[model samples]
Target chain A: MKPNNPLKKEKIWRVAAVLFWLAAWQGGAMLLNDSLLLVPPARVLQRFFALVREKSFYSAVLFSLARNAGGFALGLAAGVLLAALAARARPVEYLLRPLMVAVKSIPVASFIILALVWLSGRRVSVFIVFLMVAPIVYGNLLAGIKSESVQLREMGEMYRVPWPDRVLYIELPQLKPHLMSALSLSLGLSWKSGVAAEIIGVPRGSMGYALYQAKLYLDTPSLYAWTLTVVLLSVLFERFVLWTVKRAYARLERL
Target chain B: MTRLIDICKAFDGKPVLEHVTLSLAPGVTCLMGVSGRGKTTLLRILTGLETPDSGTVEDRPGRIAVQFQEDRLVESLTVGRNLQLALGRAYDAGKAESCLASLGLPGCLQLTVSTLSGGMKRRVSLARALLYPAPLLVLDEPFQGLDADTRGAAIAAVRRGAEGRAALVVTHEAKDCELLGGRLITL
Candidate 1:
């Protein structure tokens, strides 16, 4: 096992680097004497605290969270199901090949704009997030499934174990790591694409709406604050979800 | 009875088993072959997972069990669960617990297959095959990872398990023939 030093004094070098960068930002803001291009870190922090107290700000956070999370969950389900099907049947994979390629190649902004004409603004983020995630989940999961050792499957067959038993015992253990890889990559992508969709669609009273309002009104501090809030939420949610997956893996390794 | 007649197996373009004929009844039989000489292929053919180019097998009992050259066990499941999967619902926990006890693997039912040493996994696979209520058992190098003492016990367990059933074992060890009372067939 490796040494455990969560935040040793050695990290002080990194801290110094961070502090130096922040000082540089403050100096640049002072020289610019303008809030439009960039606001000082202190003012941004102030606006962050101010927004933290507002109930509507919490609602905005919740709104984006709900849509993005919902989309991610749906994508995960569909991707696994589709990958399983595709793995077992060549016809299914052939049918899906074109669609998966298109989904992978297309840009997020294109999809967001195209979806706006068809879907309600409130649902655009969900659709965009789902689109962004499904192919990654599908491709990685299918690859994972394919990489499964055939020796294990043949042993299961010789034992005459039931289908469910084979899936639970032989297939699942090999599949878990691949599924985790898919989830880690797709979760971050969904957040980026989901929020971008929201900013463009500008559904009423969302985080995107707040950011846009701050920009239009020249409230640089509020805009910077909201950006920070989005960044924080994205990081926090990723950590929480990944931590759960890692715990599951640790438990499985002991099984 | 397990019968293979006119068995012909080929890979790519070359033939492995050509016009081969064999039969095995209710006894321990050892298959001896050179490395890469297609012992695994023949075993796979017996399991119906491989197709011989021109062969017909008869009396292949359903619910047959195999302990392949490789462990072929889920490396993330407990030893007990591995045996349970092979043995089906007929597995008695007490019986399984006792078997593991005798095999020096007691109190390890909760341990995952991945955490086990190579010898431990070999024993687990051996135990799984022995516990399964199959009319026929196929084992390929089942003693590969066992120490001398463990090998003796595993040989005894296999003999007891194959008392009224047909078994096919593949091993290069000469003592394996004497241990299991196996009739030798060299290819």
Candidate 2:
């Protein structure tokens, strides 16, 4: 007989692992014997279905999603622009070094609290998310730009390759892995920091606010449901963004 | 008539090229040397990528086509796109295809450089140099990885490409100079 497909086997193993975890969670919840302390996975799923039927749930999801996405876009643009400037000029890199270090080292909770004091609750999540994302992108891309091959650059110079062509053909290919890494790292952090800021700020009509309400009422099932919703949304957003970028790279390679 | 007069270059106080004077005319000139003989440094100086510690370069061409020792190709891109990147508006698909075919890389325009074998990538790099329109051509170890027959074919192609232009080629083999029917300059 022919060997089994590795990809299919891997998929089956992954599914089995997930089922095993669910069973463990169910067992742990039963042993606890307190719904408030540990709601079972089945109850949480039921609660999630019921919560999804509410119009307020959609509003909350949309509100959090928009703020996180906006903050991520702003961070991405600023990081790329700063990285380009830093790559071109040594002084710019030095000037940004301290700021980037500070941003990377500072605590997310501290930034969220500072943002809350400076801005309204409605805007805190966006600010926090931006702060979380910019430094990661800037640092990774700067390294990528610095690591571009000297030999290839000399080849471009010798041939008098135009500025646009040099960037498209030489620089972009070298930077793709760095760019993807920055995106993957910053995207997950954006969601985490964005939701943390929202919960602290307790912005109305947001997932964070819904989570806070669930906590305030000591409703374990509702809290689990909202948490699951945020995770699903985050995962879907990451997949979509990564897929779009990969497709664009594929198109460029074809060209 | 490009000339290097009394050129001297050193790295960390060790001399690489000292008081080297040479002239390049409109024909193929094959440069032969052992390893660590500063052949690449001379090419770099001629191409203005490195400024000699002491020398005067006269009438250097503003544009030159160079094939560096390494196949400095964009690994993610297709062969045609690499040619297009270097040649810009001067790129002709028909000319490029035929040039690649002549270099023994037929039907390789659509293949990504990363997928190609070492010899194939070398030819692709050579094809880029040949296709680029310039007054001077500089190739460093252009026939490094080719077999004997392929090397002969590549030599013929390089000679044809060097017509009406100055070609500076660095190679280890004295036979390459005889094959190209060019003057020999040893560093």
Candidate 3:
């Protein structure tokens, strides 16, 4: 007989809990007898399966995925560069303080509306995601760089250790935890605000457009299915990005 | 050999080291004093980490090695990597292995610094300074976490490393001076 595994047993219970919830939802929908108010889980799943088979579904997924990924990459690059600059120079920090604070404090919706006037609908999500994520990365990484030990830095300087080696051996490891935390928080915000922008802009071939169309026709099952798709994609993307980051950190340690 | 003439340093209007003049010449020089007496401040001024209010450091070496009060090892790096970082282009894996072995940390090259005991970390810090090729060595509380036997061994290792070179050490224990076979200057 196969050995009993606690982790496998735990996963079994999680699946059972999800099934119980689905059954409860189906029961509630039956009691109401109104598909418009609350669609049954079975119907939502069926619609989701159907939606996945369509070519437009793929198009919508790819369109929004591309914009969001583009924005995330751009924001990560710019944030890391700016944070490095600001950490080293007091004048740079003072110059960027007001702009970073403004970016952080401004509402996502206001930015979306303002961006709509200057950019095309397709680029709106990209701009909003960039705006949402850059400040988080900048603030967290700046704090990480500042948290480096002055004593260690002095030790490096006295030893005449090269600047690149100091950064690789001293600063990067110190920044790892802060960078991981910032990425975790910003990745979710990237998707949430990106989707929100897409919905407002009504980009022609995007997931947000599908969500809007489902609501316009009062197709509750399709709406639920589209929402589920967005959630799944977001989770997959997050897991992929985090796994990549973990691998990179492992490599750094090995080096 | 390095020399400091009338080095004076202060923090927030309170003097830490006042008009202190000393020289390190081809042997170990141990600085001993009570807490807050500026023994460390003097070492810092010699290492160029801090500027004296009114003093000049003479014969400053082109290259210097130092072990701070804290271990200052990158916690994520292995023992060998820490030494390599300090030594830079002069790093040699075989030399590092032998150095660690001499410090009672054999085969520790593969282990991350965080996994080491406090005494082990202190030894690693000392080993890094010893292995680096420099004319001058500044060691601050190098035996802080070691037992009597380990402290003796570290002192011997330091003496071996400091042969034909100048070393400045700061410690609370007067016994360290005798163990290191060096002169002690009480602040």
Candidate 4:
């Protein structure tokens, strides 16, 4: 038999904590005696498993995942590129400052409604998710670039290190923490805003549309199931992305 | 040879270095001074990292390598990685290992820079600068955290690496100048 590791212990605690919450939910549902208002955890799980057996559920999950992933990748790329440009040029920074501020200050619902008017329901979520993620990534990366190691940069200059090598070796390593933070925060945010946009837009074949249907039919178990799916998918996706980035960083450091 | 003539620098209306003239040739030259006397500023100017108020640098090399007053090693990287970043395509693994061995840091190439002691970090920084392919080398307080025996060995390694190259060293210790057999220039 293999010995226990801290990771296994951590997983056990996480599962226990989740089970504890589920038990409390079940107890509350039992006391209230109203499945309409609050469904038990077992009912939610049963509905979720049944959902997995349906074709529409699979289609909705795929649709929502694709849109969210696409918007996130686009925003990440644009934010990183803009941040690099802004860090190097003062005029670019000045040009972007007010736009980023306005994006940050405006409400997400406002953006969704405005985008819905200008774009189709299919594109509205993509646009909303992009708007939600870009500013955060840009801000965090700009801070990281601005606060990059001047000592290391100077060392690179002294050694005549090429600009590409300096960025790869010195700047990126320093920016890893900030990039990871931006990714984690923005990933959750993109999912929230993207799903919210879908719910409001009620696009066909989307998880959000399924949620709206559940609400309209007063299916509390399905509501809880769909919400649980969203949360679980979001968490799992975040873990996978962070793990990939960490591995990439480790490999780059070796180079 | 790299020559500095009538170099002056000030920070926030306070003079750090004033009318300093010095010349470096293919040998070790030590700049000795107390703290805050602009020894570091002079080295920075020589390396073209800082601009002097009004002066001309004669016969400056096209490329220069420097170890700043701070060790300035990237804490996130390993020792070999740091050296490789500096040396780039010119890095020779065998030479690098021998150089580290000479400074009493054998088998430390893969250890991350953050895990190293202050003395070890200092030597690593020096080794990185020394490994870079440049005709001119500038080091500021390169022996700050080293013990007496390690300092002697480090000085010997530096002297060996600096052969036939114009090297400028900054320090406050008189014995360091003697150990390096360097020509003294008091600032």
* Native interface contacts retained, candidate 4: 0.84
Model 3 residue A238 CA deviation (Å) reads 0.7
Decoy 3 TM-score against native: 0.94
Off by over 4 Å in 4: A1-16
Best by DockQ: 2
State model 3's lDDT. 0.91
Q: What docking class should model 4 receive?
A: medium
Worst 10 residues of 2 chain B by lDDT: B148-157
Among these predictions, the greatest TM-score belongs to: 2
For each candidate, the DockQ is 0.68, 0.91, 0.79, 0.75
Shift of residue B162 alpha carbon in model 4, Å = 2.1
| Candidate number with greatest lDDT | 2
Runs of candidate 1 with Cα error greater than 4 angstroms are A1-20, A248-255
| Candidate 3 C-alpha lDDT tens digits along A66-157 | 99999999899889999999998989989999999999888999999999999999899999999888989999999998988897888788
Error of 1 at B90 (Å): 2.6
Runs with alpha carbons beyond 4 Å of true place in candidate 2: A1-3
DockQ of 4: 0.75
Tell me each candidate's TM-score: 0.93, 0.97, 0.94, 0.95
Q: Interface Cα RMSD per model, in Å? A: 2.2, 0.8, 0.9, 1.2
lDDT of 3 by residue, B70-183 (tens): 898889999888888888889999988888888888899999999999999999999999998999988999999898878877888999998889999898988888889899
Better model by DockQ: candidate 2 vs candidate 4 = 2
